[model samples]
Structure formats: structure tokens, C-alpha cells
Target chain A: MVKLNEHDGSIISVQDVNFYYGASKALTDINMSFKKNQVTALIGPSGCGKSTLLRLLNRMNDLIDGTRVEGRVYFEGKNIYDPHVDPVDIRRKIGMVFQKPNPFPKSIFNNIIYGPTLSGAGSRSDLSALVEKSLKQSVLWDEVKDILNQSAMRLSGGQQQRLCIARALAMNPDILLMDEPTSALDPISTAKIEELIDELKKDYTIIIVTHNMQQAARVSDETGFFYLGKLIEYNQTAKIFTKPDLKQTEDYITGRFG
Target chain B: MEGTRHTSSQYEMELQDIKDNLIYLGVLTEKAIASAMDALLQRDTNQARKVIAADSEIDRLDMELEERCIRVLALRQPAAKDLRFITTAIKVNGHLERIGDMAVNIAEKAIILNAEPQLKPYIDLPRMAEIVRNMIRESLDSFVNEDLETAEKVALEEDEVDKLNEQIFRELLTFMLEDTRTITRATIIMQISKNLERVADHAKGVADMVIYLVTGKSVRHQY
Candidate 1:
């Protein structure tokens, strides 16, 4: 329900962002800002730079060899791309959930505490409370309350996705980057994850990349329409889906083009 | 923006069919208004009865178009311009169906007036009917083409129809005062003119919806 002009509370801003995979450019002069306590969905075709733009938020592109980025990505008041800024520290503050439900081979309780334990977050009693709170926030606690010691891989596909979300939640990040987080799950899980995304936005800024247009319309406060490595249009979700001014945005939303 | 077709040819064709049928329904209602007026002018009870019988077809088209809009909302999940057009179509469809009923109302009064001796010669009454009938046609034309200019023209003509309706009422009041026998027929003539005036209002409603369809901003009460 936030207006387009009310984004002065932006938590992260990407200014003049460009990405290249060795010789070929992937994203071209992209500019966007992620407001606090809101979900921004990036939607387009498979190679539209939507996913590439998402990974740039927390410097996930740093792991790739031939990928190079040229832009200033500001998180809070500081630029995360500064040479002194640690990518690992930046990633810890900006957690991510992948397309597949990639829980560790450990037990459910261990999966939830993997990140916090490495950071030496708390004592035994504190870790127990954090696990319960994170699982509850992800809406997976009731289903797995009695079986916290069970292996995460043994859970259903939907349950595993929720577990991955809980693992990210345990880190207590300011933002959560999700890359097609529900693409591998069935309809029931997708709905539950969507509900959680709505709830999660109350505390964290969420940036999601997805192929499903309806999901983008349903969960996002703002949406960016990407095409061929260009950010064609970015606006509030209601305006983008109801009365887009641009012809390309209308054509894409109305199923006029592939 | 013209002839910018959808990527999915089937979806584009389906949307076009819905729009075409909406205009077709508009045409049918315009014919109803003209026939009902003709029946009154010629004092032909058979023509009035035919207009009454054709009301069922208008009702049928209204239902079919509603179902098509609901189907598009559910299946196509349309967005942007298509979304505005579908919503506008539903509102305009309601206005046209109500206009058809108003025509029937006029026909029922026409049937009663035909049973009695003719009152004073109907001069402004037929003129009012012609203006209202043209309003219906123009409103539908604006909706089909998403023409803002035609929609604005239709909105402006509604004021003229209202003035004519008032003039007809003042002229009929003299007939009721002069003779008691003429009072009955004069009242019915007044009701027929009132129905024609209402038809103009419904046409204006269709025009307002067309403006909304073309430019997502509403112009309902501003005019």
C-alpha cells in the first residue's frame, strides 16, 4: 500500500548498476532502490538480468570468476562495494534463499543454527529460543516441533523450503534475497511461503526474483520489470499490473509477448 | 498504440470477441429505442408488442458478456490496459441493459396511449426520442473505439435532452388543465417523455465508463 514517492526510507539503493559476464554485458545502467520493510519483486524471462540484479545486492557475484560488476550498491548509509567491506560480512547481514530447498544434511535444529553458531551468537539456552523463534516466524514450527532432531532432507519439498527460509531467518539479517524460492515446491508450499513473505516484510526488506507474474503482483509492494538486461519499468505493484504507462510493460503483463 | 496485438494470438482474439459482442449488444438496444419510439408515433400496437418481445435477447446478451468477463478475469488474469477494458465493459454492459428496459417502459406507455384518441400533435416528443437514440449510438461508438472526444460529446448532449424533457412537461400541463378527457392521455405522454430522458441518462453512464477505459482516471461526476 506504500506510494511510489514514499521510498525516501530506502534501505538499499543500486545506482547506475551494470553487470558483465566476461565480454558480454548482462545488466545495463540499472537504477533502483529497495525501501525498508517492503518486498520488491524482480520479474522477467530467464536471461533478463533479474536474477543477476538480485545477486548483486549482497555481492554474490564475487564468487564467480568471469563476472564483473560496475556500480555502487549502498546498504544502509555505507556502500557495500567499498574495498574495505568484507563480502562475507555483507552476506551475513543480507541472507539468501535459493530456488531449491537446500537444507544441510544435518538435523532440523542444526540447520537452523548453522549460521548463528559460526558467528558465536549465544549460549545453549539462547540458541534454543532463537531456533524456535526463527521456525515460528517461517511458519514451519507447528509441523516440525516434535521432530527437531530429524534430518532436514527427510522433510517434504514444501517443508524443506520453509526450513531453508528459517535458516536464513536465524541470521537476523536486515534483508532477505530470494531467487525463485518457491519454484521447486508444489502449490501448497508456494502459498505458505508467500504468506511467510508477507509476514517477513514487517521486519526485513525482501528482494525476490521470480518467473511467476501473479506471485510478483501478489507479494510485492514495488516491482521492477526487466527485459534483455534492461530495467524497463519500475513502479508500485498496483500501478504496474493495473495501468502501466509503457507499451512494453503492458504487453508483458497482459501476455502479449513471450 | 493502435493495432498493438497481444503475443498470444488466442488471447488477443478472445478479448476482441468480447469487445465486439459488447458493441453488438449496444446496437440491439439502440434498435429497441428506435422501434419503441416508432410504435408510439404511428399508434401501432403490433410494433410495441414486438419491442416488448425482443427484450429477452438483450437480457441474454448481457448475461453472456458478463460470463466472458468473469472467464477472462479467472483464466487470462489480464493486466494493465486489458484489465481496464474488461472492467469498463462490465459497467457499460449494465448501462445498456438498463437502457433496454427504459425503452420497454416507453413502449408500455405507448401501448396505453395508442388505445385512446390522439392528444395534441407530438412535436418535441419525437425530437427528444431521436436525440436519445443518437446518444445511445454515440456512447457505444466511444466505448468500442475508446474515443474520448465522442464520449465527451455524448456527455454534453445529455443536458440538451434534459431541457427538452422539461419543455415537453410544461407544454403537457396546459392540456391537462384545458379538458379532463385529455388529462389521461397527456399524463401518459409525459411518462413517455420521461422515459426517453432516462434513456439519455443511461447513455451518459456508458460514455463515462468509456472515458475511464481510455484513461484509467474516472470522469463520472466531474461533468
Candidate 2:
């Protein structure tokens, strides 16, 4: 219920939000605000509503049957849950990367240009430039540049994840949501994805749901510890790991309990 | 509670082992200081030689304990309170080693003073050595228990040792001025007092690290 400092306009705000599936509630009253150009990490055990919360940010939860959401979610100073607002338009400003690297069964060039083409970006020259720019931004251009016309499924798992990121970037969204984006990759690929996230935070507001506490500590500016669908603590990453004010947070970060 | 309990119980056992070794070192240093003072006051050359010979074990243990601390820091990568404990152990281990060296200095001075006739009864010097010994013991205890209040109390007692040093310096100055014959013995007694003062200063340094370990704030120069 605490109002954070009104600095450079908050990119996303969740005010007293709660989500439910039929008669069962998945998230308690959750109040959080993420600043522009900053990365926030959500950490908790399995079934802790971290992914559900990320989906709520972009209204992806609306696709689930019997799901009900309460309270306001403000993006760019406008309430996204307003009755007049279209869910499709809300999705265009916020893009998502899932836990698995799910590239479509199409050419690599087609995958990166899919979103922009669907959004009605004009001209063949503009589309090609957008594809190149998105691929470069995701750090996948060099490896896939020569094989632009090859099937995306033919690329490696790590390359496919980066291609998924490029696809998201082609939409030209201001915010990015990654739900355990590197959980399936090897250590080297995880490192690459981590490096990409670090670089992407400079130009895009990022919210990541990660189970790895060390990753959260290394990459996030702010961290939220969730338990039983409720946020137990939220603070700076250094404070959360070293000298947290709440005992629950200290116990969790020190590996006391899940 | 489960995970912290596991790590802390392990830390507690290791800390206890370190405390036993440190206390063993403290007792050896205390005996050395006492015997060195006895040789000075009673003119016993045999006791002075024993004090000089006993310093080898203290030096050996100092190396052993320091090696253990380095190994733990490299292996465990301890954080927060555990990090503070390991760092304070290193500082305190150094302090105790220096105290052992100071005792050897006193023993060497006692041997020279024993060769000459007694100038005066060693009243304030033995008292200062006793205070220094107690400070070393209490500082180690403060570190073992993470007791901030006891650490602060030990820090405050440093002024008493400083005052005793000044008192010994003035008394020796008067003795040296009164007669040329008493100059050598008086200067040696002044050196012994200075060594004891340094021991107290090292003890205070250990206490300061304990305060930092418990509160996560440096109190080295704040008095």
C-alpha cells in the first residue's frame, strides 16, 4: 500500500491487484511499481504466481478460462484494465518471451519480421531494415545472417530463443516480460541470455520471473520475494541478499526454505 | 531457520575449536609475562630463560590458525555474519600473534635486568600486564559470542592501560634522573611497560573488529 517515489514516470504499476481462477485465488493483493529502464526480478517457489503475475502485466491471463482479475494496472499513465481499452492494443506495447524457445515453423527471416508485418508496418525496405535491426538488437544477427532464409526450427535451441527475442523486439514494444527465459538452455546459452538481458535493460523496461536467486541478485536492480501468492518482501537486490529488513526475506535468500 | 541453523551450527563448532586454540595461546602468553616480571623483581635468571623458550609453541599455533582461516575463506565464500566472523578471526589471530611477540620482548628485557641488582619493586608493570592479559581474553570471548556490548566494554578499558603506561614512563624518568647507575634497569622496565601497552592496543583492535562484525559498522577511530 506504500506509494513509491514519483520519479521518471513509472512504466508499470500494479495497485492492490488480485487474480483468481474460478473460486480459487492465485494471487493475493499485490502492489508493485516498476521504474522505466530498470529490471525487476520475481523469485519464489513453484506455483507461487510469478508467471501469472507476468502474464497479468500484458493481459495474457485473459486467454485463460474462468480467470478473473481485480484492481488497476496502469501502463504509461493509463489504466489497462479499463473497459474501453482493447487487450490487443495493450499487448503491442508489452512483449513476452516464454520459458521454452518456441520459434514458428517458418524461415528465420520470416520469424523476426512476423510481428511487424502483422502490425501493418509498410514497405518491403522498412520490413527488411526492421528485421535486421531486431536481429542485431537481440545479438542473433551474426550467427543467422547468412541463413536468413533457412527454417527457424533448424537453428539451435539457444539461437531459437534469441530468435524469439528478436521476434518480440520486432514489435517495437517499450517493455519486455521474460518468464524463466533461459531455464532450458545450457550454461553458455544461459550466460548469453543473461548478457542480453543486461544489455536490453538500457532501452527497455524488463520484468523477469526467475527461480535462481543468484541470477536475480546479479541481474535485477530490484527483487521481490513471493510466498503463497503474496509478496513477502521487495527491496534492492544487494539489501535483499546481504541485510534484508524482514526475517522471511533473509531466511529465503539464505536458502532456509522454498 | 533450517538452513541458517545448519550453517551456524557448523560455524559454531569451528569457532569453538578456534577459541580453544586462542585461549591456549593466551594462557601461554600470560605465564610468560608473569615469569618475565618475576625474573625482573626477584632477579631469577632461570625463570627468564624459560619465558624465552616457551614462545615457540605460541608462534607455531599462530601460523596454524591463520592457515585455517585462509582455507575457510577460500572454500566457503561466507557472506554477511559469517563473512564478518571469518574476517574478525583473521584480525584477532594477528593480534594474538603480536602479543606473543611482545611477551618474548619482555622476557629478553627481563634477562638483561636480572643480571643487575634490583632497582625497585615492579608494582605498576605487573598490574599493566595483568590488565593486558584480561583484555585479550575478553576480546576473544566477545568475538566468539558476537557480543557487541562486551566488545564496547573492552574498547573502553584501553584508556586504563594507556594511563598505566604514562605512569610507568614518568616513574622511570625520575629514576634515570636521580642516579646514573639506575638508568639501564629503568629503561628496560620502560620497554616492558611499552610492550604491555602495545598488547592492550592490539586487544582493542580485536574488539573493534568484533563491533564491526556484530553491527556491520566500522568503529575503529570513533573512540
The digit string of per-residue lDDT tens for model 1 on A26-106 reads 999998888888999998888999999999999999998999889888876777899999999989989999999999999
Candidate 2: what lDDT?
Answer: 0.83
> Taking the tens digit of each residue's C-alpha lDDT, what string does model 2 give over A137-202?
999999988999999999988999999999998998888999999898988888899999999998
DockQ of 1: 0.69
Of the true interface contacts, the fraction found in model 1 is 0.84
Give the proportion of true interface contacts each model preserves, from 0 to 1.
0.84, 0.14
Clashes of 1: 1
For model 2, name the residue pairs that clash: none
Interface Cα RMSD of candidate 2: 3.6
Model 1, B58-89: lDDT tens digits are: 99999999999999999988888889988988
Candidate 1 lDDT for residue B176: 81
Alpha-carbon RMSD of each model = 2.5, 4.2
Q: What are the per-residue Cα lDDT tens digits for candidate 2 across B77-190? A: 554455566777778778877887887888788888877778888799878877887888788778767788889988878999999999999998999898988988888888
For residue A28, give model 2's deviation from the true position in Å.
2.3
lDDT (C-alpha) at residue A10 in model 1: 74
Off by over 4 Å in 2: A1-9, B1-4, B7-77, B87-120, B176-191
Candidate 2 chain A lDDT trough over 10 residues, lowest sum: A1-10
How much lDDT does each candidate structure score? 0.90, 0.83
